[model samples]
Target: MGAIESAAQAAAWLLAALTRELGLFAAIGLAVGGLDDLAVDGLWIGRSLWRRATVYRRHARMTMATLPPPEEPGAIAIFIGAWSESAVIGAMLRAALAGIRHGDYRIYVGTYPNDPETERAVLGVGDARIRRVGGVLPGPTTKAECLNRIWQSMLADERASGRRFKAIVLHDAEDVIHPHELDLYDRMIERFDLVQIPVLPLLANESRWAWTISATYADEFAESHQKSLVLREAVGAAVPSAGVGCAIQRAMMARIAEQGGGLPFSADSLTEDYELGLRVRAMGGRSAFIAMPVAPGKGLVAVRAHFPETIEAAVRQKTRWIIGIALAGWDRLRWDGGVTERWMRLRDRRAPIAALVLAVAYGALLLSIVCRIAGIRPDWPDALEPILTLTGALLVWRLAMRALFVTKAYGWREGLCAIPRVFIANIIEIAAAWRAVLHYVPGTTPIWDKTRHRFPERVGE
Candidate 1:
């Protein structure tokens, strides 16, 4: 009986210590991260409203002038690197062949020699516009390396045909290309060296859990593509490439290749596309993030693809992103830009800290429940109350903005679902952050962490 009492007392003391320490840590993290998020929210809202009132109102012609389909659109070279993507490559190529309205473009699909299944699928597409570029290396090389081989293939083709590609577009094997995507790229690429269109994840109607997990991506991307990237570009910040639905000037690609020692994409980096856009901006190349409708009644010319619908897959995908942007990216890309650009970089690298805060916050919540069941109430500290309240308010504002943007992109039902989906997103992010730390800290070889993809039956509809 005495040992049982002693054990219970020790557990209570341990719980109290964990609760206090975690609360203090969480408070500091929340104060910093919350304020940063609040600043971005203010900037997005204030800048958007100001532009609508002044710049947009001053030039009615700006809103009125619509770009017509180009009669002589320049030839575009599309690069798609595939390893074990046999499942969706054929469907994606077929959709792109049928859907794209532009006449002057060729797709260079890079395939590994060992990945015969994927190679066979690309060959099975049997379109003249699709050129299958055999990989020099075996299967499972980095995505950047694969893309570089495709670039080499394009260069060889240019040499053989005596035709120069006007622009180079990058895409994954699972993407559902928009019909007017090339048109938008053709019109915009003439002005901006890099043109990035919005990317929206297609929501899968599977099991309830699957639907919720997939909706988390929809909520995040809807808010991010509509609000975050728009604001980043509006504030004169360099827009990072989404690696899909983006076009870069062929000249700029050549310059980038020359600077990077004959490779336009970095073979050593995981997020080569993200770095490519920043590098272009650093080299005085103009970049733009466009979210405009192709026609009055038609939807915006955005790339649509299915994101990971399972927690494990989502974690694996996000783990690569966290490592590339937050960990490895910091070492590769310098923080050398304007105030807004630096701020955006900080936001990009805040994933680990955000994950830590989230874990501590959840831990505190669980401990509080344990204390309550044990009839142990924590001593309320008055000093931390204001900070906690402010952070709580900021969190509410963040969620409200997420819902607003999601509702604008999706419907009100998804907007409401976005509220609870925050928790789901947080869980996946925390897991990814942990995995990224483990994977990156040990200095393991970074390979292409490819996620399995699915193509919707009604693609390009």
Candidate 2:
């Protein structure tokens, strides 16, 4: 009788443990479901508002008509990446041509060490205004290093010539530019120390892969450029910079140079553009986002970056970004400031917690499944049914909202289809978060992950 009672007690304890695990799994699933709904809905609403508020066509015309002339001849400095045949590059060249034809801006192309193909391409244009500069410093062979070297070289040249630039613009090789992009820059230079215009993605009729890349970029840019920046400005928060389509003042560049020519940022962060913006904010400098007016023939610019033809390449590129931005740079986000700073801090803080919770929930779900397979009974109370239903509803609503926003930014078909992909991506992102945590434990130099480009042969050529 004593042995039988002991065995019964053991069974009860096992049952209790199994019950707890099942409950935890249910709760977590509900929570994640709710978050998904919230993210989608919020993003959709925010994007829609941004689109309606900024009337691009009228703004562009107004800007062109009233803006002052270029501060001086060769006052504008343009930085172009030299590699590959990207749609973004084409757009940038078009913009450079426009600047040469209309604005009195001096264009400079900052490129890798002696690429004959790039040289041939640039020379083919027969434009004397565009000058190419090689030998970017630090010799790391990364974009950040290349950019820093270019900035330093440009500054040294300016100082030697006793001519200071009024404005500086960075362009990727894949960008498409409108004729009036420079005019927009001219007007904005009058007000803001740093100004950024919309960086749209190219829309093409061929290749679903192209469409996918373009649409994804469109969604991302719409959120970051239009909604987030506007909101940050309204709340007096530091507006983070995008990688390209950025223009800065000469005085700001000089100040950054004083800080040791480190790409205008204090730290060697993966998201260098964002870090630069934060540094600018820390120094009491202001930045603004300019609305790109879309008219019949007046779209500002579009880039075709990484139209990955294969799933493997897409995954590799995304993983590199994840490791760089989410994993390596997590700790570098500055949280000690005012109210805006506090909000940013909170956002960064919660991301890791969310990832952990997801991991825990997944673990619990696996435990629950295993216990059930082993004939262990779960003793969850029936009273929790209502709570579980409410949680699940919230989750579905959140996902629906995100889907709606994606649809508005891209299209319903692609956006809705991407929901599952987004969830999978979040799981991968969580892995990145864990990797970041491991990196912070000891002596770890940030690993530079390089993405290989796929330059497919042009169709019908």
Candidate 3:
């Protein structure tokens, strides 16, 4: 056939794929995804309005008070699992040691035998407060396994020092510890078994058009920590740890350890921090997620770090998250919780499916564009009118919610930028989700896909 005729044939195939796939399956997927997001939106909005009407109004909007440090602060163990983190570990340790206000704390850096560079970096810190623990396995093992070894090191140190840690804090090698976070954890762990502080992503120094990955992290964490997590705790759903800025009370860890065959952190899971919180809740432990301002000048008490700046790095990091939380978590945790818990779990598990929907939706758009460019109009069925309209409306609502949350975290600039970055975020997430779903087999173990990170120049003291 001639070139023009071949082009027409391809266009025809594209339209057929769009009509058959999108009309039959993607439409329903879109609607279901909309409803799932709507549920969270409803909870977030309702909780916000209620708190504004009651708690904030009653307290006169003065949450940042001159809080006292623990009179007798208990020892705290800080665990950081390092894999290929030689580039950032030393700087992170120095910043953390310098910034932390609490004196009764020890930092343990877990390093694999194969990763000598990271071990050397950790050793170079040479601070009496920092201890480097060799990993049980070689490099690039699952983070959960490394954390388990870190916990063991914490226990050994506890035995040697004759001082028990009141609580154990979790952190990453790239984290810039906030000055007030340890103090906050010190104060809060007294009341709750598990305490989680907000995690903020630091934007890169370079000005570039291709850095939407950083913005995606900023937007997601801002909304999640500010709204979703708070709402989840209010509704009695389990609070998943951000893997940084999280602390579990010593006694709570002991209890979870007792339950998990002497290992509080599961070696089988990719998202151990997430599972830790949920499993603790399952064992009837109290958890707190506090987002209030820590100091008079500083905003919330949060661990700040720069996320993966490039697309490949971002997708690899997010793929681990999706695999651990959505897929592996579902397989392990199963559906065992109250109404609120079940609802939240459903939202969490919906990620892979929603990602597929995103892929299909974008594919449909591309097909339509190609057809239009080829001067071929698609004769979509009239039955899809309502489905298309509702899906469009839901997409708008989702975007609006995302923008508002991003605005609350960053500023109006980022909020407006989030509108465009939404597409970029979805594309990245779809790629990650595909890998996550495809990587798992019935009895096979998942490989650790670690994301390399960098420390920003400035982290608040």
Candidate 4:
């Protein structure tokens, strides 16, 4: 009887301690979330108001003028790094070659010697503009390393052809290139050192209504590329590269190489793209993320690609990003910049803490349901009331912004569906953040956690 009583008391104590911890985590996590949401919301409103007050009249004039692209297109080279991208490389190259509106351009694909399938795929494209550069490193090296080899090839190509590429473009095998993509890059790189057009992740062949692994990507990216990056560009904050649909001016890269004493891209980092953008800003180079329509008619010129569609695939892909950008980034790219920079950095690095908060929140939720079933009452914290109120409003605003952006990128159907996709995104964040911690703690070797790519077979297909 004493043992039974002791067991009951211990169990009660355990529950009480867990409940207390949950409260603390909730308080801290919600505070972070609230700040992030507020920043995003503030940026959104500020940008809108600014555009209305000033840029609207200029935009009207630009639209009325119908600006023509440069008569003599600048020499630009597109580089795609393929590790095991045999399935989509050929189709991507073909689609890109067909879609390019510019004349003076070249495409260089970095392939591993062991990756004969991808090499053959590139060769099969049969276009003189496309050159395959096999690297000394074996298959599955970091994307940055592969890109370095491609850079060397680009240098050799420029020397041979006697035409210096004004800009170097980066892309992935799965990307659906816009016809006006290089045109914009050519035009923008003439002014800004780095140019990033919007990246719109295409919906995988999934149910339009079903909340899938890929929809989370679509929802998050829609909000990010449309608003967050736009705001970052506006506020003079460092704009991290989205890996694809981005270009860097050759001159800027040359200056960057001179500064770094070798290559501009970090060969050791998993997210070299993100690091490049930040490093460029740190060195006082000009960069821009263009979201406005540059394509003909009302179409917003953007890069389209399908993200990971399965839960396992999405988790793996996101794990790499979380590890690279937040976990590894924290240690390698020690904090810099002023107030806004610090704030943005905090938002970028908050994923691990957010993950803990999410786990505790879910656990607390389950505990509440169990307590109800068992006829027990939870001792709720009184201090949480106001915080909860503020966080709740932030969450509503966030959801509205997400839905609006998703609608703008996809359509009304997706925008409405993005409301529920929020929960799925949270799940992905939790799983990926924990995985990132695990990978970072052990100092795991970084390699290409390549996503299986699917190319759109036809235009708008």
Candidate 5:
């Protein structure tokens, strides 16, 4: 075919994909919103309360039975990224102390040489159990690289001491972990090589910014960590790793490092957690997801990372994540070979179709808004109703499941408030994914877009 003819065909295909995606989105919005309303109403009226109550009961029983045995002792290594402020570092130190008190665990904190506050905070823990390493490490200043250096040091220490760690847990500086998180780690050590805990965002009751951060993250974990991980596990699909609240065995970590250390910490990918998860799975390891326990009132653990507190900061962080995960890691994970290599390869190839569809859907919505404002109706055919309906129903089911999980993990008030944020988050994510795609040029060094923490005013000085 002539170049002009080929171009015409490509344009036609793109348009068709966009049209189909828009119909899907509209249907999804309507169905999910409607079902959510129905669920709320039903819960208020008491018909679905039985099911909800039963679920609650089962969860309660599990929590009660899953307490860690006192005899089962394990060491935990916590990695807080470079550039943490004092308040954030302080919170981490407190949690580290708690972790030490709870187990026969030694705390190994990995940080940069220049972070004096982090170093001081490690000392502040005042426990001989805590040790700091890699004060000065080479290579990219990304989280992955920091972790790699720490892991290498840990391996050396273990070899010298002739002892192996039972678990290695990653944590952010702002994390305020529930005491029971250590217990959960102990209980689950026997069943899975790696255990990932759902991370809950701690929002200050008075801060609107906190509310936004809480809702967005809560909804995300609800869907991705809770439901999606469960679904993926059932179907043998590759699961993405959350950066923190995750624990891996020494044996598994060693195995992954032996396999080319997968991708080194670099500026190329912003999502070190996702990349690590992919590499681990690629190396024939198994991972399990445990719901963040709610008994401690705030669940097993919650992270109180300081969000942008302003719109620009939030947008920058979200944009970086979007570009990194959707653009960089998406390609890397899709292409990475492993036990589920073929399946992942196929999923990665088809995943972009969803992003392209979303982009088109947004464009159509903009056009529709414009048309409505101008008193013009762009006619869509009646024949697409069933397709639209099915698409909407599926989306509603997905979101409904997400909302249910969120409500259970947090509370109804938080879950309900998070609905709008969930939509906004998805749009941000889609935009990030597309942005990453456009910038996927060759020879791009991974950029570590560092997030600034709002240290307590006293610490800030």
Candidate 6:
């Protein structure tokens, strides 16, 4: 009985000490990050209200139908970088060819020489507009390298046909193209050097909707497209390309290529699409993020695709993103921009830190639960009360905002799911951050850490 009492006291003391440290750390980090998020939320809300009152009051609200069509549609080239994507490339091409309501555009599918199955699938599409550009390098090269091959092909085709493309669009083989996507690009590319539409994850079947990991992407993209990117664009910050549903003017593409010695996308960067968007802004190119609906009460004209549904797949994909944006991106694109740009960059690079805080926060919560169950009272610091209270309130606010945006994009069902999915997302983020640290610390060349992609059975519906 004495030993048991001593053990309980020791455990209680350890819990008390660890809880104070972790709880304090978590509280401070959450407060700082929560304030940052609150600022963004305020900016987004204020800007949106201002626009609705001022701009919409004066002019008719702009929807897809309201946007003026290009008087003379210029040639647009859609580039899809495929490395061992034989399974979905054919379906995606078919969907794009059937869906896109444009006349003067060509599809450039870049496939590695080693990935002949994908190249064959591209050719098998049998559409005259679909052109297969075989990469000089073999499979598993950087996506930027594959895209560069497609760029060269576009240049060669322009020279051969005596027709130049007005804009170049980037997409993945798994993307479901919108019918009026090219129309939006053709109209917007004339005014802006770069234009990005929203990307919504497609929950094609009931299974996909039920998959927690898959549903998380829907919540994430919905909120990001509706709020974060919108806020970024409103503040004139560099809008990062989502790798799909984004178009860059041919002139801007040429400028980027010239600046990078004939490669528009950087081969050195893992997240070349993201880097391309920022580089465009750095080069004084105008960019816009458009999230308009096709009609007054219709769905958004956005790129839709199936995201990784399994935890392992999701972790692998997110690990790549964390390594690229949060780790290597800092080394490549050092802090250089206006205040808004720097603020956005900080948000982008906060993933590792955020993950750490989240981990510690969860650990502390678990410890508190154990203390209660074991009847071990840990005398927490008096100072922690206010901080933890504030943190709790901010967390509720953050979850509410997440649910609000997600509900606005999706429906009430997903909105409710978004609350619990916050925990899932935090776990995945922590796992990905740890994996990213391991992968990035070795100083090895970053290859295409591509995950297996799924195409919707019936896309562009």
Q: Which pairs clash inside model 6?
A: none
Give a tens-digit lDDT track for model 1, residues 199-304.
9888888788988888888898898888888888888888899889889999999999999899999887788989988899899999998888755555778999
- Candidate 4: the clashing residue pairs are none
Better candidate by lDDT, 5 or 6:
6
Off by over 4 Å in 4: 61-65, 206-211, 294-297, 441-445
Q: Candidate 3 residues 114-218, lDDT tens each? A: 989999999998889988989657878778788888888888877997888999999999998878788888878888889998898887757564367787888
TM-score of 1: 0.95
Clashing pairs in 5: 27-392, 113-135, 267-446, 267-447, 268-446
TM-score of each: 0.95, 0.72, 0.93, 0.94, 0.75, 0.96
The TM-score, computed over Cα atoms with residue i paired to residue i, of candidate 4 is 0.94
> Model 5: residues >4 Å from true position, as ranges?
1-60, 64-72, 99-101, 124-126, 135-140, 261-269, 292-298, 301-309, 335-359, 388-399, 454-461
The lDDT of each candidate is 0.88, 0.58, 0.83, 0.81, 0.60, 0.89
Least lDDT summed over 10 consecutive residues: which range in candidate 2? Answer: 452-461
Q: What is the lDDT of candidate 6?
A: 0.89
| For model 1, the run of ten residues with the poorest summed lDDT | 60-69
lDDT of 1 at 59: 60
Most accurate candidate by lDDT: 6
Best by TM-score: 6
Please provide, for model 4 over 283-381, each residue's C-alpha lDDT reduced to its tens digit, 9 standing for 90 to 100: 898889887576335667788888888777788888988888888888888789988887788778888888888888778777767666755555667
Off by over 4 Å in 2: 1-74, 81-102, 114-126, 136-140, 202-218, 261-267, 296-304, 307-330, 348-353, 359-394, 418-420, 431-448, 454-461
